[model samples]
Target chain A: MTQSPVVRLQDVTKKIGGRTIIDRISLEVYPGEVFGFLGPNGSGKTTTIRMMVGLMSITSGDILIGGHSIRKEFPQAIRQVGAIVENPELYRYLTGYQNLVHFARMAPGISRSRIDEVVRLVGMESRIHDKVKRYSLGMRQRLGVAQAVLHRPRLLVLDEPTNGLDPAGIRELRDYLRKLAREEGTAVFVSSHLLSEMELMCDRVAILQKGRVVDIRAVRRDSESSEAAPDDVWFDVERPEEALRVLDGLGKGRIEDGRLAVTADRKTVAEINRKLVEAGFSVYGIRVKTKTLEDQFLEVTRGESVG
Target chain B: MADFLRLLQNENMKIYRRVGTWVMYAFIIGIPLVMSLAIISVTPEDPPSNWLFMFIASNILASLIAIFTVVKAADAVAGEFSQGTIKLLLIRPWRRSSILLSKFLAMLLFGLALTAAAFTVTLVVGTAFFGYTASPEDMFSEMGRKNPWGYMLLWYLYQFISAVAVASFAFMMSAAFRSGGLTIGLSIFILLAGGLITNLLSLLDKPIVKYTLFPHLQLTSYLDGGPGPLPQYPMTLGFSLAVLGVHFAVFVAVAWLAFGRRDVA
Candidate 1:
């Protein structure tokens, strides 16, 4: 928590033609983590990402990248950031390698070997010589990542990066992004409407609705158990009634489909598991029924249509 | 400064790497040859003088060159928007003004290259058909200037200036609009009809006609040692260039304003 953030949005707002497209929203993305902006279509996810990367100007507030204000110091702030605003719209007339070379010339200190290294990292070396017009959407996406990372930016931002990828390609991108954050310590910021994808890819997520940050929280429970509130935990045990009795006064416990489900924090669940095991009961497994972002969204929107 | 050159390299790569761009260049080289060959077949025994042929061929080639460069200039920025690559192009470390300047400079370079190619082809074809009977010392051109070579060079220079002015106008249109087709069509329409508009507007004889862009679009008209394209107007090459300069400055200003401040979305 003490680490300085790589990107910070402080009450950033955007007004386009007298309409507030992005309201005042504040958040920070620290290094060595994957932050997500989760919202539905037209909920200002792309607007926020555009402001973060300087594609759109902020109206009322400021965004800082690597301690440089994006408004006052654009070239310096953008120097530390690499971003794909919506889709990876590259030059389709040029070959993939030419595209990489084109982007490499925009920033300083990107050698030919660095371009090759990024191509290999994205697994695009085989088709990197082909013209981008002949490439499939997934291939273009990989080349897009290669160009974005060629400069070795401190912050990498991808807005809805999984739009056209198949299942396997999406999984590969998720793994690569996590590795990018872990090994290189690059702060990866992604914006997506797909909750399952964000669940798998991001370490922390900020839920935006109507251009406002509704909630921001850590996604992984293990590394952030201190902030874990009470969630539904389903316990698999040998006894049906004894497990219920063990969790009698702790919280509301119910046996659902031959399994004991309790609404309790992680600590209470661990205590209940230990108590059931000590009372001559075999605890087979403990599953924390992590609430999906979709469920939270549904709760927040009150069953309204998200799309 | 070196980094700015690298940015220009990126712009040049985008400009020249396309198949269509090479096709345009081929047309620039081919048009004069085809015209010369047709002229030879039409008048086999009685070919025109070298200077006459050069003027005829250059008039046609130069107009074609202007149109070609204008088309390219129209695509300079609007093509990026059509292909959705402007987002990527603008997100780099450079400022928006620098990006627009690099693109405009590349278009100017393109205009200059096509002008040079057309000049070389016209001279070669003109000399191939008719011998260089008149030396550089001979009295030359419709104006009968003593230095024929200097007169021809000045004519082409004026032609190049006009083409660049029109092309820069197209560049401005490209930056301000999102549709490549509209930019190209509108620019060519104005170019092909500019002569007619200038003639019609000169009848007014008002002082404003001297200031309008149409009166100055045909800079090569001054090569005959005339005061202006419209003899009644009493305009000089210096005066015509000043008018064109004002127009060019306005186009560049509008392009920078539109490209610099607009949101990429």
Candidate 2:
């Protein structure tokens, strides 16, 4: 059985100034999963996220967060979400600790201990006492994440959290977010135009183009038996020429520079193994390398006009 | 309610920490000091300085406070949008109206504090230099023998109302315009040019123009007991209060609606 979704949108549409920003897009985000929203600039990724969090009103259809309609019960629905859209803004004049304290007040039942805990969680305990104006860009981004999760929200929505970070900062953020999902069981919905970054961070991805979701795919998960199998499989072998001979007549196969590439299913792999053994060819390795999410996303969303 | 109060506290901290707050306080203190020096330099043979002049001059300085307060309030909301802070704010699981109200209340408190400082300084300096030994009754007699205490209270209240009116207008413009300069510039223009526009309209003999908020921006008109530049109309005080009230209500309503529906990308 499928897991229940923490956030669900059905045929949602958004129009601004007589132009459609998002058009009849449907998506579901399950619990404790990092759902990457991938798109190019002006592809309505931000608009869709805003609709899910009730920041932007939906022109048609409905959005439900944990079984609550966002339009009818926005306060309740939005209460479960914590988002940092675009740039993270704090009171520039106030110290980092003071900024957190101020935002903590707005969060119901957020104690002082929790504020300190979030500061520590983001690795900002040392500089949290310093004014935000004095903070570096990386430090500010950490503080932004600290503020977003202060309420222990079920769903954390971030738009391009790594936009301006250095490579080290990006790696730190990626690891921290993974730990958050693994330990805290919080679902993440992140939007970014960087395809490779999404591939590293997301368990599943939804590709949006021209105000519509073009495709949704689960990364690192085997395909279901009911669905069509993947069309391509890559294998690294010791004897590429020998493996190619064994894989012949098992549909189109090629041996390219010690790698055996085949377009076949799992059963075909078993047959290839049996044939290789009979032919006295040692198959050192046979692994089906999955397609990179970037290739799939680009293939799906190419040549689309976006707002 | 607790959440609302927390938001208000956050807004208070934001405004209080700004350099602008200190600048406003300095202006409040500077106004009375300049007036004291001016009064002291004059010959005693000229009309002796009295509490009435002190009151009128202090009230006029309050107008500057009102303008400063309005500029601050305008930036309170619009600046958030331009700086990309609105996104962080909207995702906080609170209603948009609550945030707006918290900022409004903070600005109001700041305005009142500035006005009170100016009033207190003028009173102390006027009392020390002029040696006007007069109770509330004597002060009222000096101002054409009117109800001095009542008029003083009314004047302060009117100043508060005018400040709030200006704040609301600035906030409305801030919501409509993304740039902070545009919001503050338009608000100042409206406040400074309202009288001039009304005067021009009067030359055209448009009786209905008198009812607008322009002619009533002067809080001291209540102390004067009669209209000076504009013709006296029935329920003059009520009409002035009503005009300010309507202006405030309309601006706040528009701000809330516009902000609630805005697409914050």
True contacts kept of each: 0.83, 0.73
Report the number of the highest-DockQ candidate. Answer: 1
Q: Evaluated on chain B only, what is the TM-score of candidate 2?
A: 0.88
For model 1, how does the per-residue alpha-carbon lDDT over B1-265 read when each residue is reduced to its tens digit? 9999998898889889988878878887787678778888998887776676777777877888899889889998999998888888887888999998899888888888888887787778778867775653233455534555676788889888888888888989999986789999989988888888888887776677788887688887777666777777788889899989999999999999989878878
Clash-forming residue pairs, model 2: none
DockQ agreement of candidate 1 with the native complex: 0.76
Residue A44 lDDT in model 2?
88
Tens-place lDDT per residue, model 2, A180-279, is 8878888899998887788888888988888988888877644433334644666656677766776666747886555777777777767777777788
Candidate 1, residue A127: lDDT: 92
Error of 1 at B20 (Å): 1.8
| Residue-wise C-alpha lDDT for candidate 1, range A1-307, written one tens digit per residue | 7999999999999998999888899999999899988887898998888888788888999999999998789999999988887888889889999999999999999999988899899998789999999999999899888888888889999999998999999999999999999999999999998888898899999988888888897786555656458888888888777779877767578988888888887778778877888887888788878778778767775665667
TM-score of chain B of each: 0.93, 0.88
**Deviation of model 2 at B106, angstroms:** 2.5
